[model samples]
Target: MNYIIKIIFLFSICTLVVAEEAIFHKNLKIKKDDTTVNVKGGFKIIREQFYKNFKKENNLDYNFLEVTKKNPRHGDTALELTVGTGCIGSKADCKRSNFESKKRVEVSGRKIGKKDDNVWMSMSLLIPEDFKWGGRLTIQQWHNDIEVYEPMFETDIKNFVGLTMKNGSRKGYFVLDKPNKNCSAGSGDGSTGANFCIKSYQEFKLLNWDELLSLKGKWIDIIHNIKFNSDPNKGYFKIWINGDLKVDHKGQTIWKTHGDVEKYFGKNRWDFKFGIYTTSKMAFKLYFDEIWIKRSCKGLKLKRLGYKCKNLLDQEGGVKPYSIKDISGNPELAGTL
Candidate 1:
């Protein structure tokens, strides 16, 4: 068994905004005469319009999603969880909430407006060595619809990014809801159904066992930056692990042509959620922090609020893990965040 990496405590979010896109609006937007878009977190807690951090200890709050301050990755507390289990095969082999295991935490927020631009968000995560490889772990995700004019059941599957873990490895994939010219989402291809769509995973992934073990007990920075497109064939997806750019994909990111898209939702509005969502028999705990979405570093308010930023996050030198060899017998040569 791999040495149980006991990484925990403190978490954060980061979002960058550039002030150049005056055509759009949001927490992070471009100011008049400004060319930079300000970055900020995508989450907005009740009573607090711009929540910089989860500051209160033991004070878990939210609506439509679960919140726990027991196992904080930063600040005085964090979101703690004991995942529920799921089933497979015949119906006889399953039972409970339609035989599904919805064990996870979500930072639920109002649907942001229709957007067809560059969107990015990052979160700090601490997973213990025991977090397992067999469970269905969807640590983070972004869900949106292309039928902005009205809610269309089919469009729900049109675009999404789910950062999932399977067979002991980390993977982030994009599932596009592509319907033909006559393909009314309501009809779902008029045969195969809405679940049928195009899917692609990150090229450079955190799949190396030795690589994951090296950062087991250390806080790893997992980030997702996406460029939403309308052509369903011209967008891009990117990811960074521990400050290292692991996945950089360019191509179609959504499902819609030049005319199918409805008003408002034409550009598309997406819902951002993060936390532990798994189907594991055994209980699991995950710590998350530094949740942010922005256009640049200046858009991030993590440090401005005086929230502690751990310098010892690096697995090796606490600053440069790749510069030397770790005890796990792996040579880390590319971690500097």
Candidate 2:
């Protein structure tokens, strides 16, 4: 009986390992097609499917999303997300009725990003020629969940980083933030008070938001490599625009809860949201294609584009991770931004 139990236990362990590896392998190529983008936790809430057949067929309920073959980055089809007039702001998933009538049609990857996740993502974005710039538009953001525990003590705050474009300006900037040390229970709401009492907020402006007007009606590739960590020394964020290294910042990329060690810390509590999220009255359209997310750079195949991945040896003192100084000295990444 003991021998038979041991055999069954080993089989179960082997099966679990195989299942884990299969998920990573399958995620390596998250279907590039339009109807099946395979973004886990794609939509937030389903109020009511106005178009029931579309939801049944594609597993997507939004009317603003479509699959087009006009100008795909690599494949035959790309996703086009639009927000037009007469669109009900409350129909979409957002905090407080379209962010105070800001309007949004987003794809939520609410299950992807997590604590201590070394995530790499690459995608191509197109700003249509007729896209009207008005107010603030958040193209992509790495947002954390707002947890209300016990006596209504909100924790883990807002997004740590986002890619934003403003109205009447050709320049774009990255919004980065960390938690406020002085925050306590029953603090201010996230809508006001320095963006939910964010302690460290920095906007790193590198180049044109429109890429010198050359990106209009054209596709520009963007790549992000993020090491999500609350530790100031271990976390790093790197971005490449049009295959050129544009932003490299080292520090905390996510916020942790205030108390407890086992329950609060080391939890996967972050996600990624993309697509047009704007406050402008004018309707806007955007295209996304060639979207890829991976766990490591070993298979990104971006070496031909002059991309280099740093190798860290986590020994006693073997090799340290690349710093801002090292990135600045590299000729391939120096002059572009």
Candidate 3:
């Protein structure tokens, strides 16, 4: 009888290991005439309660996608692209909406009046309050149309990063233009360098500029690191491109006066919004599959945000396991200690 009991216990342990290992997974499907992908979390939660209780105490890493099916010259078709979201809203008053709100948002694809043969799309996941500084954002793209944006608000904006691209003889990429004291970075004026722009090789080669003056272009797989060292009075900012030293700025100060720093950091305790954006014109298809954000030094740790598993075996009395809602608001057994 004891041997039989031990055999049963071993089988249960093997099943648990399989379940845990399955948590980290992904699925993607593409067709000649259509493109569809679904990202389902291994963990489920209550859709409504998850967002309501979402705070610094319950932070989790979120993912977004930006992909294209075909070259732009093929003409536009009524394509349907689905994105899973907890909430969505308009340009000014965006908020958490229901799953039915999917139709309201536009999918990145071939648009009218563009000379390029590619499509681009962008989505951003807002960082919850109580997030620490110095984290990494990872972007994986199948094609070349992917561009990730990391916006920072320091005493002064430094270490602006952009993407570089080339098409045959045309060449161009993206860059962050400096903003004027009176104007912000998003403004259309020349003062705001194309915070992120794509240049074609044909355009660059035509300039006939010096070799040193010419911009190099090609398909690139790159990662950018934005670092910030902050105190009460000031902050120092630095950016590393593709794991190499690119731009570094120092002696910068924030909240030089009063309320300056508060105004920026007050919103949900997030320093700034970091995400991706695409232009209406692109020559080739791009894909942004997965993105992971974590506190800079500690790596990616989700448990710090009040996510705890219940120790079912070690109950003080006949206590029941605690249930928490995931981002989708589905009820899930709390993690076991």
Ranking by lDDT: 2, 1, 3
Model 3, span 211-268: residue lDDT tens: 2122222111122222322232233223222223222333211211122322432221
Measured on C-alpha atoms, candidate 2 has an lDDT of: 0.48
Candidate numbers, best TM-score first, in rank order: 2, 1, 3
lDDT of 1 by residue, 1-337 (tens): 2333322211111111111211112322222222121223334322232222321332323222223333444444333333334321122112222234333334433555344667666566666767655534666556554432211101000002122221100111122254222111222212221322222222233434556556555666665556765443556666556555555555545444334344523355555655444445544556555566665434554353333224212222111111122222221211110
**lDDT of each structure?**
0.38, 0.48, 0.23
Q: Per-residue lDDT tens digits of candidate 2, residues 1-337?
A: 9999999999999765433311112322234344324344443321234333434554532345555657777656666766665333443322332134445555555466666778777667787888666655667666554332111101110122223221110111111243321222122232321112233234443234444355578777777777877675887766666766655656666665544422632343566666665555667777777665677765454553345554211112211221112222333332122
Which model is ahead, 1 or 2, in terms of TM-score? 2
Per-model TM-score on C-alpha atoms: 0.49, 0.58, 0.26
- Which numbered prediction scores highest in TM-score against the true structure? 2
